[model samples]
Target: MRRFDSAQPILAGLVSAVVGYASSFTVVLAGLRAVGATPAQAASGLLALCAGIAATAVFLALRFRMPISIAWSTPGAALLVATGHVQGGWPAAVGAFLVCAALIVVAGLSPWLGRAIAAIPRPIAGAMLAGVILSLCTAPVRAVVDVPALAIPVVLAWAVLTRFARQWAVPGALLAAVVAIAVRGVHLTGVSIAPAAVLTVPTFNLPALISIAVPLFLVTMAAQNVPGMAVMATYGYTPPLRGVLVTTGLASAFAAPFGGHALNLAAITAALTAGPDTHPDPRRRWVATAALGAGQLTLGLGAGLAMALVLLSPPVLVIAVAGLALLSALGASLASAVTDPSGREAAVVTFVVTASGTTILNIGPAFWGLVAGGLTALLLYRRTRPSSPPDPTPPSPAATELPSPTAAGPAASR
Candidate 1:
């Protein structure tokens, strides 16, 4: 069952995984571009994100009998944008990662963050999500302005097609946008082939750890991992958290040598892989996620090809596809934000601050945006926010929920 024999979830996993992977490419690329990552930095970040996602999906699938794709929180990416443009190069960035990773590992291993996740009111989570999605949707809006001559007709067509024909929304909207905006004569150029060699050496440069390690870790946890787990919880899987963190960490440790950075739980992406839309049997979804892993290996085994595609692919294609893919999520988030009368103001604050991309000091707007929203909800709208009221201090369970040194985890299970 652990090996290739587990093929039941293949059909659903395939479709969702394809869409998930494609949409993620847009996210990683857009974030990297915003941070002004060098070609190598961009490549490294992408590889880390992809490899981290694939490996996590496989682990969660096998562990929980469901499809799980651990994805980076694009919100986290928003947080790290400033770091990329900061004074330090890759070395400093590495330091930042170590810090971030340590924080996450502690959160996962300890009961604090875990309890927080469980305690957070469902409505608040929904509001936070709305804020996050609203922040990302603005990408397309700005992209449209940046390239209006081409963007105008494309976006107009997307609106018309999606408005008039609901079922034909995503693919149709994307098709119209990409085709209309793309310049002709653009095609894949030949790439150099490199021998497939497994790399295990991560040039441990301690000096730069402050910069690289912290930012990566921060974004990974707050943005990527938290949401990954949330998505799983939203779907009601509920796997072990510690194991998921450790495994993703291991994946990151291994892949770091190959230019991968922080890997963590995938929230938004897992929904794609684990939904009924992915497969009927929860036990079979692993196949679809496994397929995603294979794709990552392909990209790794063909690094030059990966880099070339990143370079050659039209920016318009990325924006158009990404915008359409995120459209549904954005709508869902926005709806959730305002659904509760009490949370309306807080949610609006989240949407505006986040969408503004304004930073507080060096911290990215996403983090501050969340902090701002949470505080406001607590202070101003305390009456409305569901009272988690200190866990009714019940007698402790006779035995902890652990196997005798065994039994184990997912952001996928969030």
Candidate 2:
């Protein structure tokens, strides 16, 4: 009983890592490919991400004695898929990754930059993210229309499991995709199962920086890091903002040469390890994140095999799985996008431009979406003066106090 009790947090950590990796790895691979990485490079990118996640999670958990879960930026991957190939191809994209990493570090050191990011209204940020992922979210329906025989089984598996076992739905869909590939008689020949890292010398170009780096930075910060902090805070943990930003930014920089795009705080999966469900005592929760690091290291060893399976399968089927995985994120983004009446028009404009996949002056629609939305808000949104003077009464202590954990509600799913 003692041994089993001690192992609970470890098991929770492992579960969190598995769920995080399985749910969105296809998106990572697809994003790498979209940015012109070859099969080998994409596999390398996956391996690099796994290594970074493992190293950073373990280091932070141990250093802070807190459950600080780290993850590859899923929405950033979706943004990559939307942006497609850019100038200087994979190398340029890599350069953008490094540039974004520097920006993250700068944001940590410079309060002004951090404030600038925070100044972007939540609705606008949410709308931009919604636009970025809209196309990829539609891939499932397109897959069914284009390849029903393979796509239908995957969709049905995801749907059924989503209704009954939401956490396992994406993994179940991936399993269905694998079975479909086998049934289709697709043979994997000359596939390398050993993980290997291939480094590409990054080339900086204006187009990739504007198109990929800025949007990727915004999505990572708004969608992942900020919410991750809130999730931890909800559970009564205060992670050091500067340390986390610098650590993850450095990790991302180290992995960029190997094709990994970005790494940030884990929002959705943070609950698994940070909440009391992982362990009755909050002090022991860090052990669970350390176990998560071990699990990610184990998964990193199989990156080559995972890449091989993805490469051998029908593209649409894999895409269908990626689409299903992102459905929840899309729903949450859309909800946040239109929640404020004042920002509704700007958010809608952002979403439409992003979804349209337009490119002007060799820059992707995501950057343009922000520009259009900001302009729309500037021209249309006007603050009216109050009809009377403001009240001067001070708030009660209870009103100023933070909510209890039970009342904090669940963190936004990434």
Candidate 3:
């Protein structure tokens, strides 16, 4: 078992949990509603997602001795919001969730599929992610115009907190929202304190399977899981990818019956736990993720209350808070997509197509965005791709000893 010498990791974990749960929760609620979920079912979905992410984060961090942060797929939730009220409603959405989970499990089990996911062009992935969240990102301005009294205070709090305590910016904004709503007498008439889980039987529908499942799976993988892995690599922690994928996929499957959509490696919060700020020693950083898991579990117990708060507030106001929370992620994605000049045009095309909200063949813009961007990149950038230069430096001592992914177990697959 690992122990921490300082409490900084614990604090970081706490902040990560707060930000993770608070920032995108409205999006989750909106997604559930778009899929025709009742308020109770949406609350159940929140609980299930929090439970799944907590369990996976704790288990993987302990088992692998690595900082592994797990979270609900916000981009997948956004895709659900975009899909909006399929034929079979919430049950069909549940079925789509199950399908996505199964696909993730397959990807974990099959090295080729995992490699294929990894092979997706970074610019395309970033663009698709950017597109998914575009609507929510624009809500803040609309909210301010519609209800300046509520939106301005929350935005101001976010801006102020971002300057002083960057990690607490979203949480502070959320607190401001709560105060504003309450002060305005937004009564929580039917809100309940007791949390309860509700099980939903899945109803399979082909339209949802195509529009919701496929796109959700792709966005979750490309936007969240892939970036999460890259963040871990930046911290020099080479976790076993197969183990991670399998764990998260199983967690997602477990939560589906309770209405949770998708769970996977976390991109934003992973930085908090994996960085030197958590702990100077890389080996000890897993404790931060363990702490994060615990925090998530604690918060999960209050899903009913959280949902009630969201329900009591005006929809646009909740949306405005969500938009504020997602701004950082949106900026990061856009920056990543255009950072390379070679892929800039393709990335821009992908972003525009995705943001356009144009659906074709019952499929959402995300899928088409990827296809269009991929084709553009292939046509324009293929010739410009620099051929691998011959290595002038000798291989490191560890290079020959390191096994390929198949032999290395999980890490090789990643």
Find the candidate with the highest TM-score and give its number: 2
Ten contiguous residues with the weakest lDDT in model 2: 405-414
lDDT score of model 2? 0.89
Which rank order by TM-score, best down to worst? 2, 3, 1
Model 2 CA lDDT for position 212:
97
Can you give the TM-score per candidate against the true fold? 0.67, 0.92, 0.87
lDDT of 1 by residue, 105-181 (tens): 77668888657555443334444444544545555677676766555665676677668954344545445554553
Give the per-residue lDDT digits (tens) of candidate 3, residues 157-260: 99999999887888889999999988998776767856778999999978778878888888888888888989999989888888888899999999998989
Q: How far is candidate 1 from the true structure (C-alpha RMSD, Å)?
A: 10.2
Instruction: Show model 2 residue runs off by greater than 4 Å.
Output: 382-414
In candidate 3, list every pair of residues with a backbone clash: 241-410, 405-412
The collision pairs in model 2 are none
* Best prediction by lDDT: 2
Model 3: CA > 4 A from native = 1-8, 375-414
Q: Give the higher-TM-score candidate: 1 or 2.
A: 2
lDDT minimum window of 10 residues, candidate 3? 405-414
